[model samples]
Target: MSSSTVSRNSLEADQQWLLRSSSPENDLDRDERPSKPRRHIVAVLCLVLMFTVAGYVTSSVLLNNRLEHPFRIPKLPHEEPCDFAPSRPSWNSMPRHRRHAFISAVQRLASKPSRLGLSNTSMYDDFVYVHTKVVWQVHHHAISLPFHRYFVHIFEQALQNDGGYDGLMPYWDWTQDSSDPLASIVWDPWAGFGSAGNGCISDGVFARVGKFANYTENGYEPHCVTRNCLAHADAVDESDGVMHSKHWTPAIVKAIIDDSTTYRDFRQRLEEGPHKHLHAYGIGGDMASASSPNGQFIPQPKHTLSRIP
Candidate 1:
């Protein structure tokens, strides 16, 4: 063998060795080896992503259901629809017979004994007692109009249930009589609330009763339903600093109705403005008192009955 032939044989051997070292089996052994920790981390990440998606879907479904059926209250099976709405007529518009019936009912209520365990001697006194008790809270607050509205309602219920009065509550439209309150037809002896007398009311349906219950300066005591309707300029000036008779006018009422946006504003305007004015001038006796007299011409009823219903 020559030297050149020996050298060629050695190069061929080196080439064969290089091919074996770079084989697919060797690469597979190095690169395709499975790592247990990496496999566990990938599996955990996949599970977490699946659970997160499922949880989001479930929450969205539940929220939609809640929004669709927010209120779970059950409807009554035997509920009857109310069809009748009682008409609240003005005092002047009310029929004479109905007026008489209302007066009779009020008298009956006044005559009955008080259910409230206060020093109240009669049902009328019970009303006075309640008014006096909660006057401070209910007068100037947001609840003033609503409180009075309900108060009138309870009284009406009493008249209906106890006194057998079927007629609706009669509201005194003081706007009509604001100009000449004393000469108003409501004070008529025959057809309306009787005119004011010396101390106790000497006329009208309220008159001729022996005594009124829970009427006193200090405490509850039996007394007559009294009035001092004679207007004193000095006293009037002192109370409000004006002698002019202030009552609800259509313009004033319209302004209040139109301007007042919130319930609080509406209530404050009404309770402070028209209501106070009427009470000050209308039946100035027990009507003005903190613990006012039970009997009057008519319980100055509200014209609009919005708050009652």
Candidate 2:
């Protein structure tokens, strides 16, 4: 009786072990089931985490761009031929207070740190940095006019957004003083650009600009606003006078406008004739070089917005 009972008990125990929850035979299937599901869950979690991080980064960049440039708003499809201001008024038309404001804005810009990190100079020198680097690339090509137009446009934007200048950039119509540029109001001491002495400009608001950055060769060099106004100096050209190009008379500029039929012809003539001549003419100061904006004779653009990309 005891042998039969013991044999039955052993058989029951073996069956119970086979059906146990932690048995190796059942564990094979359990392991296979969860392996694929766990792998899928981990991959999905990784993807979700990656997407979350990317979304946060993209949103942050967009927020920063909006904060930095509030004026840069996307135009709607219906907003065609956007025109805010019809005409650009010259500095002569600007009131005395506004003129002073422009000067103050420029001074404020010069006080700020350089954004380009190209030199220790102020933000104003950033234009000099760009203009100097792209001088050859922009100049002597069809892109010259548009490139310079871009310069004035960007510069004006910096002045407005950064320097807090509300007035439209001023354009100098130098043709008025083609006869005697030295006597021009553009060089007035108090309200206008102060005169020069000993070859370097010692007066005017721009007198603080004692250094300029040349990105092409040197980073920054100590320089001053100087004009080539040497009527009778040592080691000079006889043909050259107080001004560089006497050929840039009003008649010639008119001929370039009136005679040119094609766009290329017009641009070419304007760039070569009036443009180059004006730069090389009466006030051949820093305005004649890539560091033109750093000087008193800042060339303002009329229809430069159209040229910008």
Candidate 3:
């Protein structure tokens, strides 16, 4: 061992030690390095959350829109080809005579076939037979108001039987209510219907109002006719507030009676009559008549206007 050889060997050994230590540390550092894959995963989660929020916002908007408007019901496929057929054209499409016939029929159905006060008849018309208990309770002794659904159905059926309704069955929803006591637009408010040939008209407000007697007495009161009945129930002549004779005056009774021929004449005249301003101040729109509920106006030559004698 020369001194130069010993120095060379020492330098080589030191180099080897340094290389081993550096290699291990470099390997560990590489092994501990973070991957880009984890970042991509975080990005995906954030996107999902955003979409979920967007979906919720969209749903809320749709729900609000639905609440504001009338929901459009989806139409189902018709059972028959003509099941969805449009009914005959509205009032204008009807022939003059056919219109008259339809009107006459309506009157007959509205008025009982026979009675003692208006005209003499052997039969006592049973108005409550077709009525529901709810309606009967309201109008037992009173005149029955026609039911809306029943009236519309019967009116449509009669019109079809006559080859088609010459005129549309006019509608009149009583617009008055307790919440809106002063609101009497009286949109063509001659009338609308129930079980009776003439509708149940005790105090003329309808079952919803209960009975007028209930006002004075606390509990449910038996129904009774009142002079304060709805204006339509009182008289077509708007001038007369509500004329009352214990028995209605024969002349007025005759005027109100709705038999076959007379009914036809009455409706024709009414439709033809000048739609006088129901209110003095406001310009009046066209005056329209409402159909009797359940009972229809069907033309019958022999039919009389009233059950009265």
Q: Choose the strongest candidate by TM-score.
A: 1
- RMSD of each candidate relative to the true structure: 38.3, 31.0, 39.1
| C-alpha TM-scores of all predictions | 0.65, 0.64, 0.23
Q: Per-residue CA lDDT of candidate 2, range 94-187, in tens?
A: 6768778877777777777776654467777766665555443444434455445645656666677778888767765555555665666666
Question: Ranking by TM-score, best first?
Answer: 1, 2, 3
Q: Considering lDDT, which of the candidate structures 1 and 3 is the better prediction for this target? A: 1
Per-residue accuracy of model 1 over 133-153 as CA lDDT, tens digit each:
544444454434554665566
Per-model lDDT:
0.53, 0.50, 0.26
Off by over 4 Å in 2: 1-80, 196-198, 208-218, 230-245, 300-309
Q: 108 in model 1: Cα distance from truth in Å?
A: 1.2
- The Cα error of candidate 3 at residue 220, in Å, is 23
Our model 3 lands, by Cα RMSD against the true structure, at 39.1
